[model samples]
Target: MAKAEFDTPQLKGIPVIPHLQPGAMAHSRPFVAKAEHQEPLGFPGELVDDWKTKAIDKMGELLTKYRALPVFLDACVKCGACTDKCHYYLGTADPKNMPVARQDLLRKVYRRYFTFAGKHFPKLVGAVELSEEVIEDWYRYYHQCSECRRCSVYCPYGIDTAEITMAGREILAHIGIGQKYSNEIIGKVHKIGNNLGLPRPALEDTLEGLEEEVEEDLGVKIRYPVDEKGADVLLVTPSADFFAEPHVDGLIGYGKVFHQAGISWTLSSYASEAANFGIFIGNYENMQKVAMRIRQAALDLGVKRIVVGECGHAWRVAYSFWNTLIGPFDFLDPKYPVPQHVCEFTYDLLQKGALKLDKAANDDKVVTFHDSCNVSRGSRMGDFPGGQFVIPREIIKASCNHYVDMAAETIHENTFCCGGGGGLLTDDLTELRVKGAVPRMEALKRVIDEDGVTHMAAICAICKSQFTKVLPFFGMGMDMIISVHQLVGDALVLGAEH
Candidate 1:
């Protein structure tokens, strides 16, 4: 994990917004997708001969299709509220990383080609022609954004920077410059049904191994079933949950919660992934395609309900977009939220007192929660406006003796991203990832100093992975990051055997 060589932002009580550095992160873009990576997602193998025209056509098509695109593009008044809000701009001191300016990369092109003012008086409108230089800028800065929508929270116009970033990425992809990390994951979901590309046979082996491992580690038998037709619930989780650190612990937590609650659930190899990278790349067709696999799995399994595992952006797509993209989901039980979050499910059981929890089991360490950005701003939990924030904390409290929050502004809907979202988690963007995490890391540092907080709990796979990789750069232990459900597994009491 590479730390920033540039003077990284200091962990101060309040972050001092730095002055502009014109091209600080210009060299920090991810690796471009090759022919093999792009074709499956219906993208060109590489940059096409007529890329400029294709890029413009794609932008025009997007503007027409998504009403928000045109609305956001036409909406900004340059109030600069969002200028200081983006973590990238604060961390990298790159003016172009400012949400409004990043939007202008495409907005300017839209003006030059589509608007009368920009067409006749391009210089007056800050518009530019669709040249290679502009395209290069799009490729560079757009990928630097994590699409966490933190700026949208402060924008008076309610402009969503994530959507603009997605549009920019989509335009780049149409020109055959798709990103390797996300495009490859999208392709994997299309072919192998998950990002990790673990086949059904491998998935089965991993789940079984997890079951046995859990029994040994915690002295309890739990079933992480797969492909069990007619099960009451179909567990559709990120493939990373099958075996990633801190993430795998969350996976164990989900299984233990289900075991104690006695909810009949099984994992689906067909729709193993909750993540829909189509939303990441701003490709509605691909997003819908990846989402439909869940619908297919639910029907095939004859399960009455669908429960998604811990994933940040995946939950956003599932909660906000699933119904529109691939929904009705009428075949599944109507009582549930179609695809319910594992957190919501666990929280519900805790509320009902359906399972026993030994909160003292977590007394050894103090805990704090990092609200995954997508869950905070993009979606909800348990039918409330801020249930996304409340439920996770409530669950952690139930399973722990001590808990703390970072800061009033830094939490809930205003939470900073884990710095590795919107497909920027690839190794190519580690510097951006490490530096972008400054605000979040600073918040955590305060809690550690003021409240003696030892562990930070997160629900998103990307959040867990990002913190695990980058925490050490700031002199924090990598293991300081843990899953919310991992706490539940720690304190959850299975039965009266003792």
Candidate 2:
């Protein structure tokens, strides 16, 4: 059996600039997808013999299709503004993990084939051919990126490394090279309506179990309705919430809010998943396919509105891309945006004094918030531009008596990824995931040491799961990372007079 060797670095309570170490993580490649995983997503079963030509041709096509790709490739002057902006670079000290260097991996290939100067004098422009080593580098480094877009925030040219990373992964997939975790899950969503491959019966059973538990604990009947055609709102959430701890608690919180609001909401077993892996791999068609399920469900169920749950990247796709990908959404009730985030819905009710909350229920623990990367950077909430950051914290403050924030830099748009994002959360990439979490864990330690913050709440399922798995390695309890709605569920007073 082959084992991954990780040189875990010690946390220093601050982000340090390490001496450049090339090839430090060049060998940290994820598992390649099998025939079954590739074929269903309309990719080749294995690496084709003409992979080099196919890869370059695919890159050219992507460059022309997405204006951001070509513009980003041509715009970067290599001024080094974003060199230290990436969490992976800060954690691993690998130069390749730097956003500029990572972009160059694909940029070099683009210049070599597409540019005039590169065809004549490739060396002068730092251009390289599409060789086997470059292909391997693409697999290793591109997967290392969470496509979180944190680097773009600091780039003087506004060069989005995430665009480059997504283009690179798309080209790789076009050439029959795909990451097992993401592609496999994409297949599951296509076949079974979720990343978990959960059938409708299993989902119904889980929701029934949750209803039973809530009734037993609170003496209240909170409904977890599924496939209820006449419901007013269709709730779409990540499949993890159907079974996973903390995530399920968040679902319970959402149910409690809907119950208290006296609004009818139902979960669509046909489109049960909110986490869309399609965006991770940069496949627009597949992404649209995953998103269209929700649109179809809404039309079929005759729901007046659609509301999304706590999943972060799913919220990004829903808020930013759904209208473009599967819209005009003319069939949905025109009063609300075609789809609204659950946080927005909950926060609006809080502002209107519609639901009663008991903040003292959370008085025993001091809490902090981890802004999941996609929510912080790629998407917005409410009517404001930075509502993505404000709404979640506002809800938390309303729910919990004691609330603190992580370091100012690590909390809002500058938030680091939980290290297991972008479909790299599988066991095969465990070493990379743990090492990547160092920067986040360091920020967390500061609050724990100074403010005695006992828990960190997040809106993303991946963030909650990642922190739970990695916090124990940092001398913290796995239970410290929790769902934001878990706090709401705790503090919520069901059936209270408004």
Candidate 3:
């Protein structure tokens, strides 16, 4: 026999026993297979009987709730026109990753169990009855998706897979497999009024810490107040910003901008976290509970406007749900309304040339942007200026002299995911995480090898963390990831040091 690739492979050390057999992997076997039908994709032993019953019922309820919406009922055409647009499908060549296939994971069940067409003739509509296997598939595939909405950008009908993912997550929660990272954050925010569960004292400490760090870094006596009354702006950021890498830099950037702008802003020790996990769970009550604090904080402080920091999902929630959930933020300028995203806010400043930048500050490196899915695809705010998703390009251009594009095909709406979105930014799903990351890494690596990209600037928190973890697998470096604000902060030419 030919020698193995490795002269001394690690397996070579273990003696082979005649009776020994390789056992099946944990996720290899069907979790719930029928006599004839293949089971859905999911981890074995995760789908318990009691959980299945509750999950089925919850799925039924979601069909009822979602079907009632005009956007759902009137919007979908089932033409399969947009099926080829899914990044996961394109990347992995997995048929189920197709947008149509992914939606059908739930839509088929909805039609079979609830819709009139399925009740009349299920076979005609391809609506099959839900099985234990189907639930397993739901848990597996649905969780595989980041619900990034990148697919929706190319969809002619504008049917968002994110909506389907949300519906599926609601069902998962009923089955008790809801990931602890997001769900637990929601619970903490609901009880303690922040996702970090930073009570009054802890929050005060963080603010003080930020102040000390800011003073040390910039050599300025900057103030970071918790609940200063009658502030001009209420600055809200994700909890990760306070505790994580690159994100903390974004928070510091906000401070420097506010200092220069002569703006009065305060963080609410009450509602510190900008991320609202209610979006993840489809729990409107919890969503409202978590979001109410922002409005209340504004009311209490008598702030004029709420300026959300560099978070994608938080901006989506703030834009889509905040108005309906807790409103008449009528107190905000009528022209601007309740809340505005930091990118848009910063872009506006750049347009007016309000903030000064020294290109030499960022001249040391070449920067290209990763258009965050939630920011570019969800917001539809790219029409502002410069044709492309102007925010990223403009920010990079303004802050640095050496900014470049990631080839035309990969820039703007066609950009790939960092693979840790839709709350998959957890530590457990290592295998799936790397698998999901291949497409993005491939794209970045090509550009890095050919065009000489020195840094990959992005706006989302999960993208930063995910890229940091997975980039090395593709021969990229951890130092490659930097937030948009960090570049801005670095480039700022302060008039006079405080």
Candidate 4:
């Protein structure tokens, strides 16, 4: 994970709102998608001849389809409740990175095209036509956002800037503009069935390798099943879990849980990926298309239950959007939630006293949980709103004896982005990702200094990968970030075969 050198934001006591450095991150935009990646997703291969008209028309379409977009555009009174809330603004000091200013980039365009006051008294109402410069600003700032929605939580209007950002991104894609990191991955998911594009044979080989490795290490015959029809559960996880460090460990953890709980589960090569990049781009069609693959896989495999692996935005799509995008999941068991988080599944097993424990297994490291943004703000687990926060913490507590929290402000709904979400995890955006991680890193640093916390557990694959890559650049060990289920795997007790 070599990165282009950039100035690292100094960790000087975790400033809540650092002094402004306008244009400090003006150069942090990500690589745009090419025609090859865009066309399969129903977008133009490149910028169109009438991209301006197309962009404005697409905005109008979004405004009509999503009622909340216009309200967010019109509702801001410019109160500064969200002023200090964005991790990008805190980390990079670019004023446009401020949630309000970012919204204004699209608001002005909305005003010029759709509002009476903006159309007539355009200057008076702060309206501007959708010009090339405006599009440039939209591309630059929107890509900088992780779409974490932390500012919306602080705003009096509850104006979710993430939606605004998504609308802006959708408008860009319709006009022949898209981010490569997300579009390319979404294309892979559609064409080859996963983000990593690992085919069925390779996937089977990887699972086989994991089985042998687990046997060598644990002396237990844990199985990683694939395409086993009639299994009760279908496991859909991010492709990163197939091989990425910390992420792969979590995959192994999932297998261990299913084995011990005696729950029949299988992974579908047809719908191998849980992540839906459509949510990142704000394209409902593409999002739904990706989700439908999972639905099809469940039907084909005859599985009654679906469980999502450790991912931030992936869980959000599965827990919150799956019912709408791919349901009615009536063919599956009606008693169970349509799609469940792996944490929820494991927690249920633990609650039912189905799995034996050895908490001392994780005593070597003191632990803290980094609540991933999508899981914290967008989705829920265990039948409650904040169960997304509580269930994972409870799992960690059950697994490790020395568990503590980072800064109070940096966990749960107020949590910071891992700086790699919203499809901005590619190496090209490493500078922005590194800087955007400052606030969370600052909180993590405090715990390291005060609590001697050695490892941070996360359910999101993006958070684990982000911290693993950026922590080294920030003078921390890359291995400090870990998956929550990795801790669970460490503490589980296995007896001789029954």
Q: State how far residue 152 of model 2 sits from its true place (Å).
A: 0.3
Q: What lDDT score belongs to each candidate, Candidate 1 first?
A: 0.89, 0.90, 0.70, 0.91
For model 1, the superposed segments whose C-alpha errors exceed 4 Å read: 1-9, 496-498
lDDT of 2 by residue, 170-218 (tens): 9999899998899999999998899999999998998999999999999
- Steric clash pairs (candidate 1): none
**Which ten residues in a row are the worst by lDDT in model 2?**
1-10
Clashes of 3: 1
lDDT of 3: 0.70
How do these models rank on TM-score, best leading? Answer: 2, 4, 1, 3
lDDT of 3 at 151: 73
Expressed as tens digits, the lDDT of each residue in 1-498 for candidate 1 is 233455555677676788999987877778889999999989899889988888889888998898999899888899999999888888888999899999998889999998898899999989899999998898888898888999999999899989998999998988899999999999999998999999999999998998888889877789999999999999888787888888998898888888888889998988989988898899989999999999988898899988888899999999999999988887878887877999889887877888788999999989999999999999999987999989999999989989989998889988999999999888878889888999899889999999999999999999999999999889899999998888998888887332
Models 1 onward score TM values of 0.97, 0.98, 0.84, 0.98
249: Cα error in model 4, Å: 0.9
User: Which is the better candidate, 1 or 2, if ranked by lDDT?
Assistant: 2
Residue pairs with clashing backbones, model 3: 41-137
Clashing pairs in 4: 35-45
Error of 4 at 323 (Å): 0.4
